[model samples]
Target: MDDNNSFQTLTDYSLQVFQLCRLLWGPIETPKNVQLINQAYFEDQQRRHLLSNWLHQCILSQPQQEQWIMQNCEFLSRGLLNDCVKFAHDEGDLRLAALVHAASGSNTVRDILRHCAHEDIVDVYSKDFRRTIAILSGEFIVKGHNLVDQNRTTYWQMALALHLWFANSASDSVSTIVRDFESAYQEHYWLEPIAHHGNTKALDLRWKLLKLYTDDTYPIDNVFDVNSYTQNPFDYRL
Candidate 1:
């Protein structure tokens, strides 16, 4: 198939998925599970990544136009800003750090912390936007419905996934499909909440008595220990 045909096919399916995405994304219409929408977008991005590669496969030897793809891919690259900035600091690479900072989602508290040069927990809570601030900062604390909070899972899971994906560039594959997969993951990590559509997923209530972790499924255990969870968490292009 030609590039035009391939892009058409890709858009066609994206539009279909967009409908479902709108619903689970917890649009204001449902006004319930208002917090859990991020998890829904994360899962849907998984499907988008796979479909993206399939579209790419249809292009054959042609050089694909990346404008639309890049538009969607922005979510992934922006999501990595905190990790990228931290990576830059850890290695003391001034150039890399600057590049990461340039692309930061400025509204996020993490971006503010990255620029602030230190994590001031006191100032964070003192502010009216502490919850948004905390997740953006990637603080990873236990609060606000820990046991059954999909928002917490979404923020931390994407945080860990971003860190693990970019930690080792040497072993990361160079295939086109791999690129698409990573784009899917990175692009779905929106700093602001996705509003609109419809949803009602028990977001308001939390089970305080029972512990959330029956197993290691949703481990907020340690930021440093994420590497051991999977050799290659972003290797999902098959």
Candidate 2:
């Protein structure tokens, strides 16, 4: 529980960074007088506001800070940034609900995720992710090549991590959940291409979010391939 750097409003960041955060954080809370054009958008804004408040309150501890950073790493690495944002927002809503309920001494998060629709449990990463859904639902005869390819590997990893994080028998550390599936930190052969594929603004914003959440030192070259803002290079080579 070291002191957090003073909270910086989204306005303090560059326009590109702010807009990217808007995508990650969802819409800001609209005024009560604002008429809702879309029910989904309204719900999103409300959830965003709630999660933001919850994070501001809960991110005071090292464990909580690590949890937030781990969540982002999983979400950011799983798919196209635009595709992942919606799922990330929904996951945050569920996490906020779970944490609130846990504080009140309830442990129903695991049951809710297990009994809900597959999509409710994790981001629809790809057809491969449908395999994860099947696995979670007790249909465990995995089909296809079962070979991890491209983002499919990350999809499986993130889905499992999310499940383990909120499960009734969940580990106390986010790193444990990662180790349960990933097992090691061997660099992927596709790292260079994956890094190159990421949008520069999105990558910068991801690093900014990571820094905001955790005080730990993660080499930027490893966390993000490069950002125009940093001019760092790919540091991980096979």
Candidate 3:
């Protein structure tokens, strides 16, 4: 098919899927409903495969446009799942972490934690460590680099430090932990850069989320580890 025809076909299919999602799962206001809608739409193996490829193409070729299309769609569950899966695999663990964070809620967090406590290598209650993962995930998403190109050394180091902080909370020496986190932020700034010229609004919103954690009182311990329980990594596309 020609580029125009392909685009048209994909657009039509995308719209159809969107409608089907609403019909099957109702309006997609919450993350649970989003997952339910996506699962229902992808019950057809053909759609599950085709939409996965289409969503990846949209993300790699025209991410901003893809985001626009997804936001405008009456149903976002499937599309969001597609986007998350595409980036999760193609973009690496960082993107997966971000998508998981975005999907979280009070109930989701508790459930994830219960599952993680039994299976994950790291302790779920380690607030500092969990918080670091969340922050790194957000940073990775905002930077928009290919997953392979991402410099995760600093992020990992911060995560380790946070884990130590949580593990040895009785010590009460948080200065080093704070410094480590700062170093991670600096590394993120230096390594993965984002253009804030045109998409100021989106950038602003991301910053707002980041700012919410700027204070010391933000409950880092509450950060949920979604990957801890599942044998496979979180792949929304599949």
Candidate 4:
């Protein structure tokens, strides 16, 4: 096989394995210590000592473990957002920065959009968001590789659905968000298992928020009429 084909196969295999692992091991929860440490670590000198102690304990508790599996899993799931931010910092990719910031609730997206050149908006909505979505989809595919003998393709589809939910809701109303989410969900019905699985609490939270914002009006449609401002406008094709 050619190098490109080899890489594609490898990626596909990785995704399958990751999905099995998640299914077998279940969702990882954020560590309380990590949260507390992060809070103290960001404080202005007031909790420096506390932060240090927390960090020390974390290190001493598991010298070989860089972070708890839950935290690691969560971070891995957000790999695309984090990478976009890093790319923005390194290469001044404002469009990427904007998308990442918006998805992550960071102020940088607003800051970038405010001062961005007029032409940049199109690039942000079209190129940047599309690329980010593709990258994230691929990442979930890789995550699937860690799974066991289970059918991990469902997990991949679920991850993609979640990504679509976030992308479609970036700046949309509650009703629009629900519509888009339902469309995405129905697009990949195999994800029903993962969606139904108790492991996807975060996905449930997103669904809950959408329902709350939409006043409990859940759209059961297959087509999503998403707003242009949310993610990329459908008019611009790759």
Best by TM-score: 4
Among all windows of ten consecutive residues in candidate 2, which has the lowest summed lDDT? 188-197
Error of 2 at 41 (Å): 36
The TM-score values for the models, in the order shown, are: 0.21, 0.26, 0.19, 0.26
- TM-score between model 1 and native: 0.21
Candidate 1 structure quality by residue, lDDT tens digits, 1-238: 5769756644653443344333323333323555665664454445434333332332232232353122212233234356556665676766545644653444353455434423455343423223333333443242322111224323222333333233222223223223432343345432221211113221110110011211134333332221222223362211
lDDT of 3 by residue, 126-209 (tens): 433333233322222223331211334222222323223222222332333334444544566323112112222122111222
lDDT tens per residue, model 2, 1-238: 1224211222233443444345445655556877878865565545434433333222221132233243433332232233334454566644433333332233354344344323334434444343323333322222322212234433222333333433214223322333333322223311221221244433433334433323356454544434533323452221
Clashes of each: 5, 0, 1, 20
Candidates, ranked, TM-score: 4, 2, 1, 3
What lDDT does model 3 reach?
0.33
**lDDT (C-alpha, whole model) for all candidates:** 0.34, 0.35, 0.33, 0.36
Clashing pairs in 3: 127-221
lDDT of 4 at 148: 14
Poorest 10 consecutive residues by lDDT, candidate 4: 140-149
**Tens-digit lDDT string for candidate 4 (1-238):** 5769656644543444344333223433444555455442233232222222332332233223233222222232333346546656566667555555564664455344333423334344543343343333222122222121123332433343344333442434334534654554455422432222243323332233234334545553311322211222352211
User: Which of candidates 1 and 3 reaches a greater TM-score?
Assistant: 1
Error of 2 at 125 (Å): 19
How many times do residue backbones clash in model 1?
A: 5
lDDT of 3 at 208: 22
